[model samples]
Target: MEGVVVRRVIPSDNSCLFNAVGYVMEHNKDKAPELRQVIAAAVASDPTKYNEAFLGKRNEEYCSWIMDPEKWGGAIELSILSEYYGREIAAYDIQTTRCDLYGQEKKYNERVMLIYDGLHYDALAMTPVESAPEEFDQTIFPVDYKRSIGPAEELALNMAKDAHRKRSYTDTSNFTLRCGVCQIGVIGQKEAVEHAQATGHVNFQEYR
Candidate 1:
């Protein structure tokens, strides 16, 4: 009896990365705040390693920014969390159909999967059946299990291709957005950033 690999959708609350990671690690989706703190604390503890140059901001500023619930997490946060958890974190990107392995150099004995569809993150799991619930999901995979791991990777690739075909990703460079604060329409990332800076309005909603 073989299991099916599937992507478990996480909420779009700007904390999808943390939630996806938490779900795969602990079967808990509500650990965003705690995980955010973990990254902040790790950065604060090693100012020399995560310096202003490396972080694109002051260490204290990065720490403060990460603690904000509205802030999104990315590569730096993934790297920090990977070291914190002592496992390889593989993010399968739908746009590129590439799996970016964080902590791969450390040769971690275990690995976890996440689906990254350009703007959002989702957890990847293997279950007994296609429609099995999260409770029956096996999110963690031992690095040595090539036979099983191959299926998971294949599944992720196929999912990514499907998402690509459906145009299910946001091209930040050329997307329409409406300011949630004032309802002003903006085009693309450049206008959005300018609008935010000028109006101090950070909330934005994308539309087709």
Candidate 2:
């Protein structure tokens, strides 16, 4: 793990799942809500592509629900991120110490990790090897790593176990944000994002 560090996005936003994966996939937290929309659209376009146990609702209904910015991404979003983006998603459930690998399971070369603390999911990505954390002026994604990197499935599991024991992943509802335009504050990152989706004017920078 020399020459590498795990990328992290905190605050327990409802977008942690997407934000975490996006940080690895796109290297930006802002694209998280947009990523949710993309996955929802993907699931809507192909109802048969996903497993029933994870669908949670009728295909169309679930698709619509997932598009809501307030909705938290879970197994469904993880699957979509893996398949649509063509990367393996190694999700570690801290409670069970079990790792669920999503993607083609054979063909996909790149991979990302999602930690499931039973009630919440958090993204964990290793920093690129060649670059020093403080040396980089701009963040890069998994695909941007020009050099080959080996899979660290066991490493991901260990990290999740440590995080779970440390209570690193908290329920996202505890975050609060105040809108810049409307000057209205909302509890939970979900509510703040939903408000932004509706008004398109809130500056969620005023985090509480």
Enumerate residue pairs that collide in model 2: none
Clashes of each: 0, 0
Computed on alpha carbons, the lDDT of every model, listed in order, comes to: 0.88, 0.64
For residues 12-35, what per-residue lDDT tens digits would candidate 2 score against the true structure?
Answer: 666778776776666666677688
Off by over 4 Å in 2: 4-7, 49-54, 104-106, 127-151, 167-208
lDDT of 1 at 35: 97
Q: Distance (Å) between predicted and true CA of 14, model 2?
A: 1.6
Off by over 4 Å in 1: 145-148
Which one is best on lDDT? 1
Model 1 deviation from native, Cα RMSD in Å: 1.8
lDDT of 1 at 6: 86
Number of the top TM-score candidate: 1
